[model samples]
Target: MDFYHRAGLILDALDNKKGSVKGLCMAEAKKGRKAGEGARFLKVVVEVLKYRPHIQHLLTATKLLAQEPTLFVPPSSTAAVASALKSGSAASANKALKTPRKHVKAAPSPLSLASVMVHDLLFAKRGLTLPKEHKVRKKLEKYQPALEKENEREKRRRKVATNEGLQIALPEKVASSLEGIGKGKKRAHDADRFAEEGAGSDGAPGEIRWMRVNTLRWTVEAAVEWLEKCGWEMFEDVQEMLAAAQSKPKVFALDAHIEPLLALPAAVSLPTISAYQDGRLLAQDKASCMPAWVLLMPALLDAEERAEAGLLYVDDEDEDEEKKAAGGDAKGKGKAKSKGIRVLDATAAPGNKTTMAAALVATEGINGRVVACERDQGRFKVLKDMLKRADAKNVQPMNVDFLSLKPDDAKLKNVTHLLVDPSCSGSGIPSRLDHLLPSAPEDEQLARIRALSNFQLAIVSHALRFSGAQRVVYSTCSIWEQEDEGVVMRVLAKKEFREAGWRLAPRDEVMPTWERRGRVEACGGDETIADSLVRCLPEDGTNGFFVACFVKDETAAPIAAPALPAAAAAADEGEEDAALEPLEDEDVTEDASAPAVSAQPVKKGGKAAKKAKSTASQAARKAKDEVLGLASAPAAAKESGDAEVKAPAKKGGEGGKKLSKKQMYLLKKEELKRKKEAAQE
Candidate 1:
């Protein structure tokens, strides 16, 4: 007998008793001689359960036929079995009975037979069934008319329920009415209610096969045309395409939100598509594309501004010269080209954003360069391979911890933009099966989330410190407030960040067209910053994602220059060289004993000595500020020049009236008193 018929027999054998399907199946298998047949029997039983929930009712009906098989067994089957029994030879009987008699019917109850026939017919309707030549075929054929009538009745009932917006209740009224046969009325009512609510509900939004045309290889028009030639049909309306996807294999449509993105029917296998194999198409999530899109905003804005100023156009030769001047090779052939914008991609593994940034810059003819860094060696290798395959010429991959790189590293000096998509809990990604299921204990998951948020904060903090970094896009594939808005708020609250003039870029200024903004509650009720964030939830036809753009506040007041400590200034000035060089593997801590330095001179000296002393003091202060991250080295150097030029002039009374002899005498007396107090200490 085929597996389905065998499964029906097992259902009949359960005899309406409440028992574990798996346990009963396993017990039946042990009693069978052929192990493979037993395994196949279990497989069929599981499949049956997946589609049908009222197993008890199904079994109850089937059990009655087991006790009275004559009313249900096919006439031909009954005749054949009887004929074999009548043949007096014992050898003939043994041979006929060699196969398991569990499914073979000498007699059948009408109820059990009807139930089995109905199940097999339903499976057949759903395109799940055995071959036409199987032994169960004869029985199914005998019940064909009754089965067809019942099927038509069901179709009408479904039509009525759909039109009425009511849930499809149990098909057999007798199953609900009969006592001790199935669930009570209350349970049935709940099931019906649930079914009604879910009738039109598209379970999980169907997975969309999103493919982005690699503009580096092919334009969107060309890619679409190629797909058309390959037997794909493009729909103008995404809804129309999605509707058609339910019935067709290769229906495709342009993505409504993201450009150069096309959504293909979920049934269409991208790997089989020729363009994907050739790297002309990228299978990327729409949400995953947000980071690159946001990262490119600054460059695009700059281009627009330059265009408005009529300075956007540059000849090839002029561009090459500019590139050379900005540290590119004479031939402009190196990865570190200077004519385009520079981007730092922290945590850039698998190279999606890196390649996307390169593609965007290339499409705009901006000659942009991307510094893609990955900490994990394995992921770094993958990133390199992806970049190479994507034909991303503008990216320079680095296998180093982004946190380990100093904010003032020479390699990061030209990076005008930063893209940070750090490690996150990935709780928002439904595609990860583990994320779909219940995770570890609540405490454990919370701990992991906390650790991830801390790491995320550290990475973004480091990225913001890059000298001259005007824009940064921080993104995570986490839906948790801790990883998204929490990290943003914490980083923005840091004194270092405020000093550096960091603030969230307004959302309207970044991705103005995107409708879904971040959760304001997640940002601790800060609506201004919340509006600037972008969030993508799964129901929005994208993976859960959070992206926030930060930009340097050009209009904010410049941080005041830090003064040198008195101890630092008076320490022979010979210790300056040692302090300038950071000790290897040593943590630098502030010397609490060093009194805060003031800009004014405190000691009496000749004009020349005072000037020299002021100059040394400024240099020492600048060095200390750089080491302590109070100021960038380049900014400190510039400030040092201004202080030197202004210091002597103020003392010489060049810009203002000089103090009188009596006023100078009083200043000298006060200076002496302060000196006496310092000596007493």
Candidate 2:
């Protein structure tokens, strides 16, 4: 930057030079004034006293510093080198020095513009240039004529050639744009949707929808009142909205994304109002509702199975009594309430299924049990937080994998219900992606998928081993057959694991349901693994999902445990036990080669043991059913003085001082009512 810096730079550059060097005269430096080099200035002022004491020291120090790129003189200083033959980026900058004008001037030259452009390196590699202003405008305009000509030619070409797709009667100019293609695709998706929606001759969206929001956060009364305040005409009936929203878009209720999860048509009703915004209501998708609803329905299990569980059954012991009573229905007084309905969501992180089950379990005075698990520690933290926010004490979190758990893990050992949502590739949904997965080499991804599936099967297999489990519901986000039906098939084909007792939940007349599209029939009432699996298509709903519920029959003789460890095998051999068997041949797939899980960690071990032992006292678990059945009150406009209740209360805290346990439960019930009211509003 200064005299010493310049002198030092010259020497450094010379040192960089590997060949013979030439003269660097002060007169020559002055000759190159346009170059702005201080080399000449130093020569004129300082060089006047050549041979001054210790002058060479100054030159050497600067020269040594110049060896590093960090110490190089920047492009700004390079202007000084112009007379000698412009060097460095400054040479390019000098060329770009535009002819000074007051207004917009001509485009910059190719070589000069290269210095300033951010992507200049890319362009120079291809020997490309920035377009001149005229050229830019002209090139853009030129596309219209050429594309038009191409369109005309295409129209003539396709007029006679029939392709198996939508007939493109419109000319190329009209059909070749994105607008046209998007319209066509939307129409196609619509056609697919409509056919699925209107399947089996007759269907109504509202009839298909069974509204069940976990009123834990908002009272139904408050929810409804808030809805009425929002100005949409309220109806206690699903039929009204179905009849109207089907004919008119104005009647369309709920968010576009929410409808598919509901797997029903939009309602003339509204799910969002001030009431929805306050976190009291969520317009859950219909297809998403199926997994939880089926788990609640008792009829899904066989008649013998339900009766053995003490469900309402007209016994032969009551034949004479039944006749005396006229109708075989027991109405009123001594009706036995459902005794402890405990559900375990083995992979329940983020609690989507857990929350849904909590809602399903909600009823006046009914306290249901839900033991939720999340194997991954980090995700379990999220599950814990969600349960607290939802005020969902009915469900507890178990931080262990399903296989690591045994019958002892469940608070209710003989509880008939379990919900298993395994980790999976979200292949069933068609959400836009940054990049298509198939493009990558996929060795890692495929390997991961295999690993996850192996773990999922292990969980389901363990769940089936539990006593009196009427339903073993297995689900995944994956669309791959290998992960979906194929995995299920492997379980079904196990010699020790016959499909003896299982029926998937069917569509109920009063509740919303998913299309049971892929459940093919199995032999001898034996559900083929694929036949029992339900695949929820993304185009029909908010997510891609698979649900399969296995009903294990204790009445059937217990099959031998498949694949005993060598230690267990040796113990069995000593006694010649018939209850032990070799591993199923079909279970040995190339992808499922991971060694058996070694052992659960000590902390997970402690909680699971405490949890497993506590779960045994099933009768102690209470149900919120008294709170759940609060759907009795019809649509009612909130009283004017009611502070005009609106959307559900937003999450986090019980609003103010911490609530005592009893009060927290009631507050959640009130919130549920408010949520239902808000959805209407």
Candidate 3:
């Protein structure tokens, strides 16, 4: 009836393997007990169990239980109680023990109840919240000093500084002896870890399984209710949810950064959940959701009228669906009025971001189209299947290399936004996840990174080439600076990128609350560039990831006058062009600084138009350089000193003479320098 009695009964059930710590506490709450009281009881039971081994050791070391024999239930009394409860014959076993509330003073205290009292006196910060006249309180007060002294002695023996330390440093022998002390077999380690600290003493946050509520099928509120109805308890704070999950079956918490996301215990069987199977809940990491959210929501939602001219809006008939997806009718308001917006997913395979973008666009009532392109045949099929499952009606899937698509083509010319998520080393994804890509040796890995970096840079540069494109969201599931910040640096260094009016979106327009920004050093120590990018590691409760948004400012003068010579401008072109080339019918010159002079009728804007034509000619020339493999000529010249390094002819034949030690060392040094330069490039 009382809190202590309730807690003792729960502990007794645990000892008898009747139920889990949370299950028993929840059972009490279901039986008309106050929710707060139930939580208190569960906390007490878990704390007692967590330190039960140490508490028992201390009790044995001090002989306190033996000295106060009447303070605990006897072995014979415990058996009689267990049998009475099991056989539904409480009166038959001990009629005198009926009505425990009135007779508790006369009966021996339950061993678990007595242990709870001892734990409070020795360890609880706010010790013993019971009345002074209470019999158990009076008994515990008598031996409080002795119990505290023994606890100190044990800590000193174990060389621990505090009670928490002593708990962590429990002797393995003592721990093995009480393997089932306070938690279920399935959650023994979890309980131990929770008791030590929320995420262990090292302070790395525990992994949480994140799911996004698919508003198309149900709202966040509906999803929450569905989970509760299915027996999962929700917590207001992620930390509290993690603690409860230690000895509980079903619990979840809302993600603070992303509104529509929920964090569940890692052990939850997600595939078996009805919501997941029905496609009402999407299995996605918090980091993976950032790109689409940035692209479709806060970043571009500011211009009300721009929505009409270029953005998409949901029809009034789909108003309720929009509200459901956005979490409220108020949030779903402000649909951009205008011609529908179009997006291109340059590397869209398996379509997670594609679906996410589609959802956000629909929820915001934006009239938008998403074109998803996958180069691989197998992944193209998977992308189509995902789009079908997600019900992304507006997306058009294509199986072709994104690089092969010309910006001026009819299919992509009107594309207003682009999502460029290309392949990388995949160092960000954990091995525990479904896929296990083979690892490469150090030398091969470096070479692979170089290749991947070039590819990523090329993809972003091509996205910037879309004349009608206003924004581009670039992302990768990679922790490497070379693939993330390195590619960003190279893109920003390009003459055409700025001429195209592309600039890194400010942090406020990005995911600002996200604490882990891109590596500042990787962005050449520029705080602004770093802030514009987002990064996630396992410690942040997501995979290692990097995402950045580039927005084209219409006010920017695309053909602004330059302050450089032609040769300097040509040499400053981005490195990605070395890995990209022009398609058929495009004419280009071999000279890096020479313009690809196409005799198209020049637009009649005079000086400004001529400047624009020259820029285009230069761009065409660079494209030709890529085709001719001359884009890397500058780097090669730097490495080999504008001429090939060669050994002089031998006295007899070319291979007949041996070189001196100094000459051999000089040749090796030059080779090493060339390799180093190649790596840097």
Candidate 4:
């Protein structure tokens, strides 16, 4: 792309140029080519010398040649030049060149390159330009008073409203539990979008979710019917889900920070908004969405494995199908719904993609599962809370570490899809997010990064072992070589992983902003994932992210070492389920502030500047080896196909058998069955 790179390519081709490279370089320097090309040319010659015979000794032969720059001639022309020079004659290079031009190549003329500044830009000193304060100061002066007035008015309203007796409320866990989730720092917010305090704490300036509703012959009505039949009652108004689905799904972030985003063709139903809903259509960052398109292409999969997902984002075109193979519905609905397809969220937690995969599963009204897992306790709780609220039925939450999970341990069989959103530095994410975390020392951040990298490697390694996982989306919110391209490179370097079965993926599109990358070995033809990995940056109005896809070969070498011990298998499977013991303490409510909060005020434009911010916590651990391994038992239900209303197996206690809890926060499936039975009576 630049002279430095071009010169490198050119100099590399000079090894076969016959004339001694050093002599030629010296001659070129004398002709004014500069030391840059000379050094490059000599390096190429030395590489050639390593492989060729007498060429390595040519330097010895030309020991005195540089003293007289004219001595540097083509290898074939060298003998004649020497003879003429020894005979006391001024032998010009033209005499040797005129002998018989029999197809020999000419050495590059060094003089023409005198003006080249090969590495100029790579070493340039530059800074970004910003608007001067005076310009904006004058423009914004008019709005200052109005802004002050609004704050004054807010105080008066608060005095009249709450001064008498009113209290604000926090979410489910308590106001105190929201400690780290709130903002601690601020980014330069646009005046029109954010309040003075910034996008956090005081105002819920909530983040937005982009969704795309599926419209296959089955509109959301049909899908909802299927869900209703199966027992899922999302609290959002049914009409609202339908309206939201049909409407162009854009973002709905809270005030404080504004950003424009698009909802994919994903159907955001009522279950997506409530506290127990999948409020935001959690999916991949807009930029990283490419790798799922490219590297881990499931489109190349066989018909059965592709299953319903094979028809992502397609609108029916009866006119095109007869003339062209437009990808729409393949087989009849009945036939298509019988197949078993699955996807795994390898390191899923805080459940973004886990929930998205759930939406896709719900759309099919068929048997598909998303196995989502988290490695840490705090994040694992986040996953639990998210799944509970979103009513994500298709996903099976596992609190197992990815590295500790084996292909078989992933009891979710018949998986055709796998998504590994491993950990990495937040380079791909906006500085706005990292700003949320408190400032730590430089060494601490590095240590955190290294720790995250190790987990990332383990997740990918284990994911690759799953035999049923044909299509995988390996992603990270990082843009480092060690994590981005480097992880891919490490997988490539493993001779067995490469030879056993793996290849670069193909892509249907490339984001222009990231088209210039993928110049490393891991990129597979300079492509990110086998050259198909996609990278997203915050600057692009998308989450900073990286995504790569991989296709597994069924016939490739197996990736197993030994079977897991029986005891370990049981422990791993039952551990998390054993963790949710009920708190023995009494519920602690704010003693004095419960009055106004209990009223559920329907005020107008109330979430403005949730500015007077404050930040909140709880912990419980279960003990092992209880009596009879049963905490308690009872409460049974009717079994229907794959939809069993089996409650979470209670903790084993004095008698060893586990019991069930009250259905206050029941899973969708069980709640539905219970409701149906109650209605009939």
lDDT (0 to 1) per candidate: 0.57, 0.41, 0.61, 0.38
Task: Tell me how many clashing residue pairs each candidate has.
Answer: 7, 64, 8, 43
By TM-score, the better pick of 2 and 3 is 3
Task: Estimate candidate 3's alpha-carbon lDDT, on a 0 to 1 scale.
Answer: 0.61
TM-score of every candidate relative to the true structure = 0.51, 0.43, 0.51, 0.38
Looking at model 4, residue 451 earns an lDDT score of 37
> Which ranges in model 4 have alpha carbons more than 4 Å from their true place?
1-338, 409-413, 431-451, 509-530, 554-681
Give one digit per residue, the lDDT tens place, for model 2 in 157-260: 65733221112132332122112111333543322222222111011232233233447776656655554565544443345555665554432233221221
Please provide, for model 1 over 410-498, each residue's C-alpha lDDT reduced to its tens digit, 9 standing for 90 to 100: 85687888888876655565532232122357755554555455546556866887887988999887788777877777666555666
Query: If ranked by TM-score, best first, what sequence of candidates would result?
Result: 1, 3, 2, 4
TM-score of 2: 0.43
* Residue 437 displacement (Å), model 1: 7.6
Full candidate order by lDDT, most accurate first: 3, 1, 2, 4
Question: Which candidate has the highest lDDT of all?
Answer: 3
Better of 1 and 4 by lDDT: 1
Q: What is the lDDT of residue 292 in candidate 1?
A: 84
